[model samples]
Target: MTSITKRKTFLILTSLVSAIAILLLSLKPDTAIMDDQTLYEKLNNGNTIYYLVVGDSIGRGAGAESRRDSWYAQLERLIKKRYGADMQGQHISQSGATAFEGLYKLKNTELIYPADIIFLVFGENDRKYMEPEEFAKHYELLVREAKVRAPKAEIITFIESPLAVQEFANQIQAVSSHYGATAIDMRKAYRQSGAEVKSLNRDQVHPNGKGYELYAKTILQTLDEFPNRKAPSTKEALYVQEDAPLHVTTSIETQQGFLYKEPYWTTGKKGSSIRYKVQGNTIGAIIKRNPNGGMVDVFIDRRYYRTINTNWPLVKERYIIIAAGIESGSHQIEFITNDHGHRFNGLDEKPFQLAGVISATINSKGTAE
Candidate 1:
């Protein structure tokens, strides 16, 4: 080939390589807004509703002065102003949390348990370390975990900044589809007639405040009906039988997290009337359903607090732990309802114990109850 032609070809190859490299680097997961360890700490108790939004710097609101103006913050403000004061929420966006970081931060931090709603915006960072296929794998894992941890929480995947372009969008679609999450096309919203977001981007990717204003408007519009609906009901089917022991009556409107079934796990039919006999601290034999002939384990801090031998029936004072599983700090405990059933095999936790009983004697950072 001619020397001139060879030189031209080399130039083209170098330019292509550079562009591809730039695209990958821009998509790196570490570049996300925040990860679990990256705490925004904007927790306020004014609202009864809570949301956990995760993703890159945009999700973290790097462009905003105090991280509060970031899109997530703006969303919170809108919710509080428009919805009411009882809509408290949190933003856990890290400045550079990639998709991988999201899995760790979300799962380890236990946000899923408390989160009534979730806005997951990611993928820009995953582009660097993985192909769309690989990103999809990890993304699926994250979704599965979310399902297990936050069964009631509705997850919405805010499509990554569309300004970054199509390749990323396609990856997001594939991954979101594999995981059964809602894929909100932020790109389409940003490009809508009234928004000037494309022009307000600080970089071709990140946007300035004006840019976020457009983003926020689009998000708020979608979220307008979010708070109006009731939280999800339990998907697990509950069966109560004549001889059924340990039956907990869960209301149809239960939210997706921990539920407390009360001191007597077994709940009798409302008309039948459950009776308990107290023998001092230990519960004496009593009957609710048919007759329990197994040992039901109770939880203290989720670690075997006590056990009840159903050799007889319900005993009021039976195995009520003195001081209720002494917790020295903020702690959690739960018990399985089926543990008392002869053939129960659903749910990891049916009832949970709160800090209602703690006192200075139990928790160092708390008062004695």
Candidate 2:
């Protein structure tokens, strides 16, 4: 071949390669919002999705007037419509469980089915239990187990909605981060929906048909926020199952108790005692404790943080408290019960939210609103 011809062919191949690279980059997300664990990388079409849905009645589709309009069904339908509705290998889960209790199920049972993906939903019931630290431990264990079980399965942990619209908004994402999984913030979707979305939600908690429709659509759209993965198709309805629940959780209705009375923190004086309750095997907390301002030694989930001078860093506790590590949710910064004796005895027995979800501009990756 002539030298000129060879040069021209080389240039053409190089240009094609560069164009392909550019296309792939454009398609991929600029940020890693989902599971940071690389397990979610796309695979061949034949690859099966043996999924396991874990959590409360939502997983069981309880609030739904019919089984058809359930969260699980909606999620499944969305998955199927996008992925050709391949249902053979998937495992439908419905354990009347919460977060802490979920640890046992995740570890002891075969529910997590060895598939390419596992959808973990909990925290609602755990909120009732109020053992956020233990729940954090269990969550970490679940992630470890999932990685061990599938090694390749992408773990997606969905944060359950709190009883009030303004609760637990920051928690789920932090916990997800500790486990090295992707944390999809549904609250953003909820917020985006505005009052109309709130109205669609049944009893201020679970979403109704309209609510579910919004939920499914927002979630599906968020899937695009993931990597260069292909979905089943846009033709698939946002979610399957028709009917849905029109009421809030009965347990939440009790309104008889709060999650923490004496939360475990790291800044208790030496020998000071910090107590936290173990609710439903997990702890659902809206921690907004800022230890950077005092000389308190932090005590939480078997860990400690030393605040030198007035600057306090978060001591290792359960899940990640959102709003710059606890500018929101339920929290209280207090001294240990026995600071004089250099021993700690946790907090009082009556639980109440010391603080609530304060609006934060830099909630994710330091992004400000």
Highest-lDDT candidate = 1
Report each candidate's C-alpha RMSD, comma-separated, in the order given: 23.4, 18.8
For residues 6-73, could you state the per-residue lDDT of candidate 1 as single tens digits? 99999999999999999988777543421221111212223345577766667776665455656766
Per-residue alpha-carbon lDDT of model 2 for 138-188, expressed as tens digits? 444455555655665656777654434233434556655654456655666
Determine the backbone clash count of candidate 2.
33
**TM-scores of the models, in the given order?**
0.46, 0.46
Off by over 4 Å in 2: 1-47, 83-96, 111-113, 163-171, 195-198, 228-369
Looking at model 2, report the run of 10 residues with the lowest lDDT sum. Answer: 241-250
lDDT of 2: 0.43
